[model samples]
Target: MKILPEISRTLSEYLLIPGLTTEDCTPDTVDLGTALVRHRIGEESGVRIATPLVSAIMQAVSSPELAVALAQVGGLAFIHQNQPVEEQAADVRAVKRHKAGFRTIEVTVGPDTPLGEVARQLSATEQGVAVVTRSGDTEGAFLGIISLDDFHLERHGAHESAGSRMRGRAGLVTAPVTASLSEANELIWEHHLDVLPVLDGDRVASLVLKRDYQAHKTYHRASVDGEKRLRVGAGINSRDFKDRVPALVEAGADVLCLDSSDGYSVYQAKTLEFVRETYGDAVSVGAGNVVDGRAFRYLADAGAAFVKVGIGGGAICTTRAQKGIGRGQASALLDVVEARDAYARETGVHVPLCCDGGLLNDSHMAMALAMGADFIMLGRYFARLDESPSPKVQIDGQWYKEYWGEGSQRAQNAARYGQGGRMVFEEGVDGFVPYAGSLYDNVERTRAKLTSTMISCGSTNLRDFHRDAVLVPVSAESFKQTGAEVQLRRPTADH
Candidate 1:
C-alpha cells in the first residue's frame, strides 16, 4: 500500500471553478432573429444560417425532394429539374419546405456578349445575376463572369467604352476597370454607380446593378432553421415512403417534405392527409411546391406543419423554359409570406412557411428571410457530391457526375407501381446519382461566402444581414464593372 497523501480542495476553494471569471457574467443581448437561429438539428450540425439559405433541385443533377433533406439542416431546394411535370410534382411532395429568410437566384448568360450589352440587359430586366458561359451552347464550359455594376462608369460614358477607359488609364490602373461583387457594391454606393459588371478573364461576362441586386437583397427575418420539437416533413411519391423517408428519419429527419409541381391536385392533398394520419404527428408534416399560397393553405388544412412556396426557380431546371408555367421567385415569396401570416393568425398552430426556390446567392437568401420564411430548401447546390445518388466519373478527361430525375419514366417504372396504382418506396430505392464527394466542403465553402457577404453589411449573424442591408438597381456599365473581370475576394470563416 503506497500511502499517497490525499489532496482535496476545501469547499470554499472548490467554489472557484476554472474558467469561471464573473466580473460581468451576463450574456450579451441578442435580437429575436439571432436568438431563434442559434440552435442546430443535431450536435454534429454546424452553425445555423439564421436565415434559410438553400440550393436548387434540378433533376439534371439533384431532385427537389432531395433538397428537403438539406433544408432539415437549414437550407432550401428548388425542384425545377428537367423531369416530367408529374415526376417533378412527385419530387416536391418528398420534403418539408419551411418559410425563412435566405435565398440565391441562379441565372446564366453568354460569354461572348459585351459587358456593356450584358449590363443593359440586366438593367432592363432587373435581374441580379448572370452565370457566364464560355460557349453559346448550354453545356459550354464556363468563361469569365461579370456583375452589373462593373460597367457603371463605362455605361455612364466615364471614358466612352471599357476598352477605351482601360486603354486611357496609365500606370497601375491598366488592369480591367471592374470590381468584384463586394468591391463593386462599395463602388456603387461610394461612387453612386448604377450597374456593376462581373468580368471573366479580361472581358466582362455578366453584370449586377445596384437596384436589381438590392431588390432581392433587402428583407427582414426573425429566425431560420431553428425548430425545436418535431421535424416537419412530407413524401412526394408513395414509392419513397419505405425507402428514402425511413432512411432520412433514421438519419434525423423530423419533417416530411411533400412536394409537387402543382399543389392543387387531389393526389397532393390526399398524400398530405395520408402522411399526417399515418405518421400521427410523430413527424410534423410540410407540403407543396406551389407558387402562391393556395397549396400552402391546402396543406395546412390537411395537417401540414409547414408549406413549401415556389413555382420555378432553379439552376439546371428547364421548367420555365419547358412548361412556361411558374411565378417569379420574388412575387412567389411575397405571396407565401402573406399566406403564412394570415394562416398563422387564423390558426393557433403557427405552422411555419418555407420558400422553395428562386435563390442564387447570399443576398437572395437575405431577401427571402426579410420576406418572412421559416426555412429555405436547396437542390442543385447540394448535388454534385458524394452523398448525392449520382456517380461521379472521368468523362472526356474532365470531372463529371451523373444527374437525373427521380420521377422520370425510368425512375417511375423502376419504382414498380403496384396493382393499386401506388408506388412502393423502400430503403435503397434512391435512384442512381454520381459521386460528387464532400458535401461538407461545398456547403461549408458556400456558408463562408455568405458570411462574408453578411460581414460586408456589417452584420455578425444572418439576423443582422436582414436588418441592416440595402438594395438598388444599376446601369449597364456599373453591372459590367462589378463582374468577374475584377477579383472577387473570398472571405475567411472568421471574418
Candidate 2:
C-alpha cells in the first residue's frame, strides 16, 4: 500500500501572515460577498450571498426562524430535513413568506376579544405585538395594536376587552402602503411610535417595528429574492429527491442541498443527474462532505452548484471515531479548492467551495476563507443563537442551547447517513452549546471580526483575500503561545 508523504493539516496548526495593509484597506471597505452557485469564469453567479456565512443542515441549527434571520444578515440557512416532507416544505414557505423590515401580523384579536385571549396570542407571537382588527383577521379593518407594554396581566382585568386597552387608531401612527421604509421610519420617529402599521385603505397589511427598522439599517445587505422575500434553502436527501425536490421548489426554496454524511457515491450521482435533467439550471443544488480532490472533481462534474469540504469534523460528528474514514478539515478544503480552481480553468465554470464544520472560533473562519473557501457552513455557531430551532435551558446557572448532529441517534436521520431505511449506528452526538443572544447581534460582531481579519490581510474582498492572504504552519508551542498566558483574573464576589 502506498501512503502520501505530506501530512494532513488542521486550521489551528497554521497562522495567517499579515500582508501589506494599504491605506484603503479597512473593515468598513471589506466586502464579504461571495457566490453561492456555479457560474462561468467571467460571468456572475445566479445565486450569491452578500456574506460568506451559511447555517448547517441540522435540526438543532437551521429552522424557518433561523433561515429568515440569516437571510436578513446576508447569509443563507438550509432548513433541516429531519422532519416530514410536508413540514419541511411548510418551513420553506414560512421563510419565503417573510418580508424583511415588515412583519406579518400573525396574532390578531377582535375589538371585543378579552385581554386574557390577547395576552395568549401575544405570547404565541415572536414579536409580542398583536393587532386589534374588526373581525380578528389579519386582513380585517385596521383598529389598533396591543403590545406587551399596553397592559399588565396583574393590573388589567381578564374580562377587559383589547379595544379598551389598545391605543386607538385615531392617535396611532400609521403609514401608507406606498410609503418607503425611510418615510415610514420618519413617521415612526416623528410620532415616537413603537409600531407603525402600514395600511392599505383601512386594512392592516403589515406592521413595521422600530427594532426591525434599525435591524434593516444595520444589515442593509440582506439577501432577498426578486420579490423581496428573504432567500432560504432546503436540505434534501438522495433517497427521497424525487418527492422532496418538487415540493421544496413549489414551496419557494431559493436553493437545495443534498445533505449526506458521505456524498461521493452512485446514489448522489444519480440524484444529481435527476435534478439536472428535471430542473435544468433553474434549481441550484449543492452537494458534499467530501475530503479530497477526486471527490470534489466528481461532484463538480456531476453538476454540483457548490461543493462542501470537510468530513467527520463537525462538533457533534463521530464518523472518524466510529469509522476511520475522514480527512483533516483544512487539508480537505485545500485539496478541494485546488481541484475547484483546476476544474474552473478547464471548463470555464467556477464552482464555489464551502468549508463545512471543524471551525471553532472566528479566527478559524478567517483562516478558512484565506485558504480559499468561498464560504463557511456553521452548525455549532448558529445552533447557539436564539433563532435556532432548539430551546435554551439553564445549566449550572449558565444558559445552553441544545445541539445534535444529523447522524446522532436523537436525530435518527438515516437518509443523510445512507445506511438504508434506518440508522444502523450513530455517527454523531447530542450536546449543548453556550446560549448566545439574538442572531443579529452575534452575526454583526462576527462580521466585524471577519472584516478586520480581511483588512489585516490587506484585502477588501473575499476574492482578494483568497489571492493575497498567506498562511504559515505553526508548531505546537507557537500555537499555544498565541493564546493569553496570564489569565488569572477571577470574578469579584458580589456582596
Candidate 3:
C-alpha cells in the first residue's frame, strides 16, 4: 500500500493567487493561444493553437473526423499510431482534404438529371453550390454553374424544374482551372457568383466559394499550411517512430510526437535525433511523459520540440498501484516547469511542456494551466465525447462511452498487436465514461469555464495567468468551503 500525499501535504496546501483587479478586463479579451511545441504552426506563420490536446494517443484513441474538427477550431488532434501507417495516413489525408475552405468541385447535377434526384443529392451533401454539367458530371466541361438565387427565383417565378434550368450553360459564369485565387476571387466578385466551378475543358475541377475564400484570406485564427490545409500532429512510439515518422511526414503531419509513456532513454533520444536530422526544420517533434526536473532537462538536451509531464496521472492509469512508481501530478508539473525555465535560460530554447492526464474537471484543467502547462492532454475526458472511437452504450438509463488507456491489454488487442498484447502488463485500465455530447460542445464549455476562472482570478490572458498567477495552500475544510459543498438532495438521473 502507498501512503497518501495528504499524509505529508494536501492539494489544499497550494492555492492560486490572482492578478491586479481591473474593471475593464473581461473573458472575451483573454486568449489561451499556444503554438506547436516547435513554437510555430507552419512555415513562417504566427498562427497559434488556441487549446490543443497535443499527443493524446494514436489511431486507437483519436479519429480523423475529430482531428479535422479540432483543426477547424484552431487546434490539432494527434492521429494515433495504433493503426497501419497507411490507414493512419489516410485519416490524415481526410483531415487535410476536408473543406472548410475554397472548393473547386462540390456537388454536381446532370443537365438531364431529374430535379427530385438533384434535390436529394444536394440535401445529402449539404452542398451549397450545385454545378450543372452534361454527362452527369459536375466535373465535365465549362458548363454553367447553378446560382441558388436564380434557382430559387425560377422555382418561385417561372416554376422551372432543375433539369430544365440546367439544360444549358447560358446563365452561368465559368472560370478556367488555371485562374489564381486572386483572379478567381475577382471573377466571383465581378459577376456576383456565389459559387464558381473551375473547369478543365467543361469538366469541373474545384469549386471556389466566395465566403470561404474571404475567410481563408482574412481569418488569422485559422491555422493553415502553405497548401492551406489545417496543420495536424501524429504520435509514434520510440520503438517504431523511425519507420513511421517518414511516412507520417510525407502524408502531411505538421508535427511529430514520441508517444512513449516514459521517454528518458537512449533509444528514444536516438530516434528523436533521426527525425530531427531527416525532417530538419520541416516538422517539430514532441516527446515525453517525464515526471521530474531531471527528465525534463534530459529531453530538452535531446531536442524534444515539447515535453510531456505526468506518469501515474491519467484517470484509468495503474502505474503507481502496480509498480509503486510515479509522483503526484501537481508536484511533477510544477517542478518540471521550473526545469523548463532553467533549461530555456541555459540553452535559449524554450521547449513547451504539456500536462498529460490527472485531469478530472475544468477546475483541475484551469489550475494545471495556471501551474504552467502549455496545454492539457486528455484521454478519458475525450473518450466520452461523441467524436471518439467509442460507441455510446445505454446502461441503467444512462449513456456511457468506452475508454481505454494505451497501456491496457485491451488497447493492445484493439490495435491488433497479438504478441504485443502478451508484453503489456496492464498498467492502464479499460473502462467507460459518462457520455458527454460532442467534442466541440465539451471544448467550448471547458473554454467558458477557463474564461470565468481566469476572469475571477483577475487575469486577462494566458501569459498573465502563467506569470502573475500564484497558488496558496488552503486547509481541507477551506477547499470544500470554496466549492459546491452543501449536500441538499440525493436523487439524480443524468443532468
Candidate 4:
C-alpha cells in the first residue's frame, strides 16, 4: 500500500506553489456595458453580454434555459438552428425574460398601433422603446420605433403637448434598420438620436435605442462555458442569413460564429466575405472547421473576427472517423497559435483563437487554455442537463445520462440533437444522473474545481492560467489515482 502524506505536510513538499489560492482568483463580474464600450463593439447595442462565454449553437444542446442562464451570467448563447425558427425566437425571448444587465428587450408592437399611442405607451410602461411589427415574426421589415427620449428630444416634458413631438418623423426612427450596433452607436452618437428601428422582410420588428442599448460593444468577458470570454451574438444559419444578419447586429453580437462546419466551403467563405463587404470591419465574424492554417489566412484576411478551431472533438461527433478528415486537436491548436501570431503581425489584425473541441475533462480544459486557445467549446459538458430536451429514463438498474454531437446522423436525421440528443438506454439512468437539483450548483462546482486547479498550477485568472501553467505529462500512477477519492468514500447504512 502507498503511504499517504500527513495532514501537517506543507504543499511545497509535493507541489510547486505559484503561491496562488482561491483568494487570488478574480471574480468574472466585470460589467458588460463598460466592456463593450472599452472594446468599441457598440455603445448603442441593444443586447449586452457581460461574460465571453457563449453556448454552442448545436440543436441538441442550446436551449432557452441555456440562453437565459448564460445571459444572466453575462455571456451570450446562440440559439441553434435545428429547431423551427419560431422555437429559436422563443429561446431568444426566454433570454430577455431575465435581464443580462442590459437596458432593452426586443419586443414587437402591431403596425396598426398608432405612433403617438406607441410613444405614450412606452412612456407609461417605461420600457423606453418597441420594435414595431409589420407582419409575422422574422419577416425583416423595418418600420420605426417610438423612443421616450426621442419623444422628449423634440419637446419639453408633460407641460409640452406630446402631439407636437409625436407628429411626422419626430416620433419615428426609420431604417433599412440594417446597421451593426457599433454603426448604430456611432450614428446615435453623431446624430444624437435615441432609437433605431429594425425591419424584417415585411415590417419593423425591433428597435435599438440609446438608453437601452449597451454603450460600448468590444469588451470581452469570461465565458459561461469556459475561460474564453464572449461578446453578444446570434448564431445564424444558411436559411436566415440575410434576414437575421441585421437582427444579430442589432442584438449586439460582437463576434459572429458564422455557424458552418466546413470553413473552407465556398458557401461559408462567401458568406464570410459578404458580411465583411457589407459591414466592413464594423463587427468581428468567426468562421471555422478547416483543419489547417490555409483557411485561417483567408478568413482572417477577409476580416473574420475570430477563427474556430477543431474538426471532430464534439462528444457525439464522428467526423474524423466518418469523414477521414481532421487534424488532432492539440496539433491543430499549436498550428492556430502560429497562425494567429503570424497573421497578427502581417495583417495587424489580432484574431483570438477558440479551440472548439477535444477537451474531455477539467485537466484537458486547463490544457487547452494553457496551450493558447482563447476559449474552449464544450458539448458533452453542457449536455445531460435539466434544460436539455432528453427526459430521464430507466435502463439496466444503473443510472446514466444522455449526450451527443451536432454531426451525428441520429441527431441530424431525427432532429433529436436540437432539443436533446438521442437517448441511449442505460439502466437506472435517472438515478445515475438525478436532476442534480439546480444547474447553478453545477456551474459553481465547476468554477470551484477550475479555481482550485488554477491554484494548484500557480496561476490566477484565465490569462495567467494560460500564460504560466506548467504541463508535465501524466504518469501511470497519476492516472490510477483518478478515482482514488471516490474509491475512498463509502456509503453509510443503518443496521
How does residue 259 of candidate 4 score in lDDT? 68
Superposition error at 443 for model 1 (Å): 1.7
Off by over 4 Å in 2: 108-122, 127-178, 187-205, 391-399, 435-438, 480-487, 491-495
> How accurate locally is residue 153 in candidate 2, as Cα lDDT from 0 to 100?
73
Question: For this target, which candidate reaches the highest lDDT against the unseen true structure?
Answer: 2
**Per-model TM values vs. the true structure:** 0.47, 0.84, 0.79, 0.60
Q: Please estimate how well model 2 matches the true structure, expressed as its whole-model Cα lDDT.
A: 0.88
lDDT of 4 by residue, 1-495 (tens): 653242221111122234444544544421212111112221332223333245676665577666555544445566666655455555554444332122233444555555466566666655665654344133534444434654543345444433333323335544444555566566666767665554444555345566634422322232322212123345665445666666666554444666655576666667776777788767656677655677877777665666778776655566566556566676677677787767756755456666676766555665666666665555555665566554555567644445545554444523221224343321111112333334445555655565566666656555566567655544457656754655455667952
lDDT of 2 at 344: 89
lDDT of each: 0.47, 0.88, 0.71, 0.52
Candidate 3 lDDT over 1-495, as tens digits, reads 655444322232566666666885687687878755644222322335876454377433578767766676666788888767788777777666654445635467666655556656677766665777666665465455554443554354433455665525666676786777778788998999777766677577777787777566544455567666777778876666766887888888877777766777777789888877887766778888898898988887888888898888788888788777677788888889899878767766667888887787877888888888888887777777778877789999999988777767766732222245364466778777899888768777888888887887888777678877888766778767768757888768964
Better candidate by TM-score, 1 or 3 = 3
Q: Residue 300 lDDT in model 2?
A: 90
In the range 1-495, model 2's lDDT, one tens digit per residue, is: 877777888888789999889999976788999999999999989889988999999999898889988998999999988789999999998888777767667788999999988888777656578888899888789888887798987899887899989988988878888888789888888988888999999898887788777677776888988756789998988877899999999999998998987888778888899999999999999998799999999999999999999989989999999998788888888888899999988999999999998899999999999999999999999999999989899999999999988888889887677688698999999989999899989989999999998888899999999998899988998956667678687878972
Worst 10 residues of 2 by lDDT: 120-129
Among all windows of ten consecutive residues in candidate 3, which has the lowest summed lDDT?
38-47
